[model samples]
Target chain A: MRRRRLVAGLLLGLLLGSSQAFACASCGSGGDDPLILYPNEVDKIYVGVARATAFKNVDADGRFSTSGGPTVKDTLTLAYGHGFSPRAFVTGTLPWLRNSRQEATQTSLGDPSLAARYALVMASMAEPLIPQVQMLVGYKQSMTHSIHDSADLKTELDVFGTGFSEAKLGVDIWFGQLDWLAGAAFNLIKPLPHTYDGLRYEPGLASRSTLTAGYVFSTACKTTFGANLLARGSLRGDGVVQADSEQLNHSAFLTQDWLISPVESWRLSLSRQAAFGANKNTARSDGVSLAYLRSW
Target chain B: MQYLLRLSLCVFLCQACSTHSKADAPAVMPASTEGVASKNGTFFLKMDWTTGPKSAATSAATLSFYDANHHQAISVDSVAVVPWMTTMGHGTAMKDQKIVPVAGQVGHFTIDGIYLIMGGPWDIRVTATVNGSVDTATVAVTAP
Candidate 1:
C-alpha cells in the first residue's frame, strides 16, 4: 500500500511538471529564427548568436496588407552535452524582435528566456532504430516596451510580454551521414488584454512538429539542411473562435565549424525559410541570417 | 583523374545552365483587375507560348490548381495545346483550360482520394512540353 501511494505521488508530480513545461504562447512557425530544434547525438557545449530580419503581411487575407510592419529579430543560445542524459547544462537567449508597419506605428523590445534540458532516453548503440529523446523546460519573460499610441488601434497591433511559457519534448536519430530529428511540443500562453482596450482575451494552445537532417562535411565540420512544417490551430476566445490558423514553415541551413585546438571550436551558419500556406491573421516572415557559435 | 575532371566540369556546366534558364524565363504576370474572380467562382485560365527554334511543332500541357495551402486541387490532365500565331513572325500559342470536378483531385499527389476541402490560396502548376524543352510555371490564385 505504501509503495502504491509513493508511485501515485511520483506520477502526479511528473504530470504537473510536464503540463507546466510545454506551456508556451507564441507563434510556432519558423521565419527568420534560428532552429531552436537542436541536432541529435552530438555531445558538447555550444553557444550560438544569430539575427533575423522579417517582412510580414500579418493579415493572411490581404485585407490589411499594410497594417502590420516588418520585424527585425535577434537571438542568442547556449547548450551543453548531447543525447538523453540525466542532467545537461543549458542557459541563455534573450530575443529582441521589433516591428514597424506604417510610419505611424512601431514597437520593439527584448524577450528573455532561461531554461534547462534533461535527457530521458539514451539511444542504444546496438539498436540502430531507436532514437535519443529529451525533454526541455523553460521560462521566458518579454520585457515591457514603449509603443506608438497609434499602434493601439487594434488588438493585433500591440504584442506585449514574452508571449508564452513553453515545454518541449524532442527525439533525434543519427544514421550514417544523415541525422533526423522529430519533436512535438505544446505551449500554454497566458492571456493578455487586447490592445483595443477593455477587450478580454484568452490565450490558446500552440503546438509544433519538426524534422531536420544534417550531414557531416568533415570530422570537425558539419552542415545541415532540413525543413520543419508547423501547424498552429485552435484559438478560442470570448465563446467564439478569434484567431485560429495554420502555416507551413520550411527552412534550409548550412553550418561550418573549425576546431580551435580541440577544447574549443568556432562555428558559423546561415539559414533561410518562408511561411507558406497560412490561414487567418497568420504573419508571413522570411529572411536569411548568419550566426556565430563558440564552445568552451 | 581526367574522367573525374570531365564529370565535375559537366556537372558544373549543367548547374550554371539551369540557373540561367530559370532567370531567362518570363515572369508570370499577376491577374489584372479585369481577370480576378472570387474563390471557387469560375475563371478562364489562359496559356500562351512564343514559338522559337526550340519550340516543338506538336506539344501538350497540363493545368493543376492548388489551394491556399499550396495543395493541388484540380488536375486537368492532357489539356490539348492549339497553336496560335502572332502577325509579327513572333509565334504565339494560347489555350483556354477548364476545371473539371472529380474525386482523387485534391491534397498531395500521393494521397488516394481527397478533394479540395475548401477555398484559400491556390497555385496553378503548369507543365508544358514544346519541341524538346519542358517548362513549369507556378501561378497563385485565391479561391473565395
Candidate 2:
C-alpha cells in the first residue's frame, strides 16, 4: 500500500494549500470599515492588509445569546504620518495580528497608536463647501494584552488592544467643492483607569462615525472614487474581566483610489459590516482592502 | 450576496485541516506559583514571585510598581508576559512567549523565553506601564 499512497498525497496537498491563505486580511476598522486616514496634506506612509470574514456557526440554537457566530481576522498595518506645521499633524501605529475562530489561531500585536491632527479651516474655490474643521488626538496602548488569544476569559471575538489605557478625540468635516467632496467624521474613545489592575476597566465611551463621498477624475491616470457610511457604539464600560464587554455596530463601504506615480498611491476597498440594532458580541464581518501609499 | 460568496468559499475550503506538526501543535505544560500578585488602590502593583513557569517551560519574575499617593515609583513604560490557556481556549504561540525588564532592577522583571504551549488554566498576564498609568497582574500558574 505504497505508504497509504504517500499519506494520501500529503492529505491532498494540504487540502489544496488551503485557499491560498485567503491573503491574510485585516486592517482594523473594528466597528466597520472606512478610516484609512483622510487628512492627507502630504507626509504620509501606509502599508495595509485587510481580510475580514465572519460567517460560520450554524447556531442551530445552542446558547450564548445576543446574536451569534462569525470570526476571522488579519490585520497588518504600519501607518505613519508627519506634518509638523501648516495646520499640525503627527501619527503613528504598529499592528500585526492574525485571528481565526472555531479553529483557533492567534497572532499578536495590534493596538499601538499616537496621533495628532489639526486643520480647522481650508478649502477654496470660492468656498466650494467651507467649514474646514478637522481635529484628532489619540493614544492607545496595551501591546500583547489578550482579548481572544491570551484569553483569561472573554470571548466574543475581535481582539487586539483593549488592555486599557485610551484617550482619543476626533472630528473631521470636509464638504468639498473643488474636486467633488463630502465628509463627516466623529470619534471619541475613553477608557483610562490608568492600569495597575486594581480592578478598573470601564469599556465605556466608544463612538465612531463616518459619512463620506468623494469624486476626482482628472484623467491621464488619476481616479478617486469613494462612498462610506459607518457607525459603532459602546458606552458605559466595565470589563476588567467581569466578563468583558462592548458591542453595537453598523456598516457600509466602497472605495477606489489609484494614482501609481510621483510617490505612489493605490487603494481598493470593499466592506460590509453587520450587527445592526444592538449586538452584544455576535460578529458579522466582510472586508477586503488593499493599500500602498507613500508621500513626501 | 451570492450566499456570502459561497460562505467565504466554504471558509477557504476549510483551511487544509492540518494534522499536527507545528512542533507538535503545542498542548501540555503548566504549573507554577511562587506567589506574588498585587494591585493596590490608586496604583501600587506587585508580582513579587514566580520561577521556572511550566506549561512548556521558561518563566521568571519579580515585581513592584508605584504611584500610590504620589510617593512615586511608576516608571515601567511597557511589559507583557501573557501565558493564558484556560482549558484550551488557545494561546502560547511559543517563541518563548517573551517579557523582559531588569537593567537596573526596580521591581525586577524577566519572563524571557516563555513557551507555555498549552496545558491547562494559566493566566500569567503581567502587563505593566508607567507615565500614563497602566497595569495588569496575574499569576494563577498551572500546567500539566
Candidate 3:
C-alpha cells in the first residue's frame, strides 16, 4: 500500500510541475483571458499569483501556426465570499493580469466576476448519495478598454480581457456521501461598448457551457488532495476583430489540488488544458497554472 | 493507497475525454452589400469590410472563400489583392496594400491601406492559393 502511494504521488507531482496553453481567438493571448477562476468558500479569502505560457498559435486553418512564439501570462487574484444565510452565499474575485506575447508585453486589470449562489435543492433521505445541487448566477465585465490596456496590442495573447460583459449561470454539486462531484455552467457574453480611433465595435458570444467533475482524496492529516476536470468554451460569438459571427475555441482543463492538513486552508493547485475544434478561430494550446490560497 | 488508485483512474479517464473540439462545415458570415458570389462552380467569395463596407476610406476589408461544398479554405500560402479602376486603368498606386488572414477567423483575409486615390468604379482583383489550388475572383467596390 505504501508503495502504491509513492508511485501515485510521483506521477501527480510530475504533472503539477509543467505547462501548456490551449486557447481560442477572443481570449487567446490578450482579450480572451483564461486567467483565474477559483475562489475559496464562504467567509474566507485567498490571494495568489498564477502564470500561463502560451504558444503554437492555432491559425484559421485549424492548424498550429508557427508565426508567433509562446506568450506568458501572470495573474494576481483576490478572492472573497460571504454566507448571508444557510441557503445563500456570494463569492467573487478581482484580478490583474500581465500578458506577454513574444517581444511585447502589457499589464492590465482583468475583468472581475461576481457570483451569487443558492442551495437550490437539497439531497433527500431517500437518495443521500445523489448530493445536493446549488445554482450560481454571476456577471463578468471586460476591462480591455481600461487605462492599462494597450491600443496597439499585437496578438490575442496580449489581451488582458475580452472587452465583453458576460452573464453567467451554473450548478454546483457536492457529493458529501461519495468521493466525487459533477456539475455544469453556462455564460452569455456581449462586447461592452467600445470605440477607438473613430471606430465603434461590440464583442459577442453565442454562449458558453462548462462541465466539471472532481474527486476527493482522504489523507491521515485530514489534508485534501484531488484532481478536477473542467471543459469549457464560447459556443458562438464574434471576436472583436471580426464582422462575421464565429465560434471561439473549445478547451478541456484538468486541475490538481493539494491542501496541507491541520492547516487545510493553505492550498495549492496545478492545472493544464488544450483548446481545439473551432471554426474561423484555429487554436491548439497546452497550459499549466500554479496557485496558493489562504482561507479563513 | 486506495485514494491514490482512484486519483490515477480519474486522471486516466479524464485525459481521454479532453481532445480538441471539432465543428461542422464553415458557417456563412453576415453579408455585406457585395454578397457571396460563386466562381468556377467550385469556389465562392464574399466581400466584407472589417470597418463595414462604407469605410472605403479605410479600405480594411475581408474577402472570404469556401468550396462548392461549403468547406472553408484555410492556411493559404499567400493572398494578393490588386486594386484596379476598370475605367481609370491603374492599380491603387498604393503599393503597400496588405492582404492577410484575419487571425483565428478561418477563410477570411483583411485588405488594408488601399487608398483608392479616386472614388470611381473599382475592381478589386483577389488571388489566393490554398493547398495547391489557386482561386481568383474580382469584386467591384463603390468607394465612399
Candidate 4:
C-alpha cells in the first residue's frame, strides 16, 4: 500500500510539473474539493475563504426589489479529512463568518460540521462511463451566540447559524474520462427546532444541489462551470409561518483550479445568485471563494 | 523551493482582495408615495415622506389610512412605525417612533423620529390597533 501511494504521488508530481504533452490520468478524480479521494491520497487539509455581497432582495413574487443597501458577508473555513479505508472517509470543518452592513457589522464563529462518506462504487479509469457514487451523512453543531432579538432585522442578518443542530444527508456522483469530468451532488439539510429568545424557531428543511462540468486545459490549469440550486421551506415561529421566510434561489459559478505543486492545489470560484428568477424572500448575491488544499 | 514560491503566490492573491470595509455612503431616492394594505385587509396605508430619504438620520412622514373604497379615511386607536431593512434583517437603532394624530383629520397621522440607520431597501412597517385588533402593513422605501 505504501509503495502504491509513493508511485501515485510521484506520477502526480510528474504530471503537474511536466508540460501538457503528458496524459493527465490523476487530474480527473482529484480536483473537485476532497469530496472524494482515492485510496492513495488519504489525508487532506484545506483553508478556504469566501466573500459575498447581497445587493438586492427577490420578493415573493420574483420581482427584484433593491430597497436596502448591500450587505457583505465573509467566511473563512478550515477543514481536515482522513480516509479510514478505500471506500470510506471522514471530514471535519470549522468556519468563521463576518457580516457587514451600512449600519452595523458582526463577526462570529459559525457552526462546525462533521461528515462521513462511504463510496458505493469507487471511481476507476476502466469504467469511466459509469459514475462513482457516494453517500454522505453529516452533522453540524451550532456554535453561535444567543440571538438577543429574533424580531430585530439586524439580529436576523447578523445571526449566521440556525441556533440548532443540523443533520445533512446527500449523495454524490462523478463521471470522469481523460481530461473531462462532470459531477452532481444533492443534499437535504434538516435543522432541529430550538427555542431561542423566548420563541421556538423551527427552521424549514433546505435542499442544495449542484451540477458541474469541467475541462482540463493543461497540466496545471483546469476550469469548471457549475450551477447551484437551493430551496428552503418557510421558517415557522412557534408553529406559525414567518412572513417571507421561504426561499428558492439559484446561482451559476465559474472556478479555476490550479495544481500548483505535487501536494498542493488552489481553487478560485466566482458565483452570482438569483440573477433572473423571482426568489421567495431571498436576496441576490455575488460571491467569490478561494481555497487552498494539501493532500498526501 | 518551488512549492514555497507557489504557496506565497496564492497567499498574495488572497490578500489582494481583502480590504478594510468602510462605511458606505447612503444613496437617497425620491420621496415614496406608495401604499400598502394591512395583513387582514382592514385598511390601506399610504405614505408621503415630508423629509427626503436619508441614511444615518431621521425623517418624518405622514401615514394616512384608507378604507376599502380607497377614498374614505379610517381612524385607528394607535399607530406604531418601525423602520426596517428587510435584506439586513434589522431595524433602526432608534427604538421609539413618535406618532401624532392629525386633529379633525381622521385616519391621518404624522410620524416623527423615523430613523434609517443605513442605506438600502427599508420597509416602513406600520402596526395599528384598529377596533381593538392589531394589524400591520409594510411600506417599502429606498433610503440614500
Best by TM-score, which number? 4
Q: Lowest summed-lDDT stretch of 10 residues in model 2 chain A?
A: A18-27
Candidate 3: give the TM-score of chain A: 0.66
Residue-wise lDDT of candidate 1 within A233-287, one digit each (tens)? 4443344554323323434444454434333446565655444333344434444
Per-prediction TM-score: 0.45, 0.26, 0.51, 0.69
lDDT of 4 by residue, A177-264 (tens): 4477678888898978877546677878988777777787866787777776778887787787766667788777887878787568
Scored by TM against the true chain B, the candidates give 0.24, 0.27, 0.67, 0.72
Global Cα lDDT for candidate 3: 0.49
User: Which number leads on DockQ?
Assistant: 4
As for lDDT, the candidate ahead, 2 or 3, is 2
Counting clashing residue pairs in each candidate, in order, gives 17, 20, 24, 14
Candidate 3 local Cα displacement, residue A229, angstroms = 12
- How far in Å is the alpha carbon of A107 misplaced in model 2? 16
Candidate with best lDDT: 4
Clashes of 4: 14
* Candidate 3, position A99, lDDT: 72
State each model's CA lDDT, in order: 0.37, 0.52, 0.49, 0.69
- iRMSD of all candidate structures: 22.0, 13.5, 15.9, 5.8
Model 1's DockQ score: 0.01
- Using TM-score as the yardstick, the better of models 3 and 4 is 4
Candidate 4 is graded, for docking, as incorrect
Put the candidates in TM-score order, highest first. Answer: 4, 3, 1, 2
Across residues A105-142, which tens digit of lDDT does each residue of candidate 2 receive?
A: 66777777787767677544365556456677788777
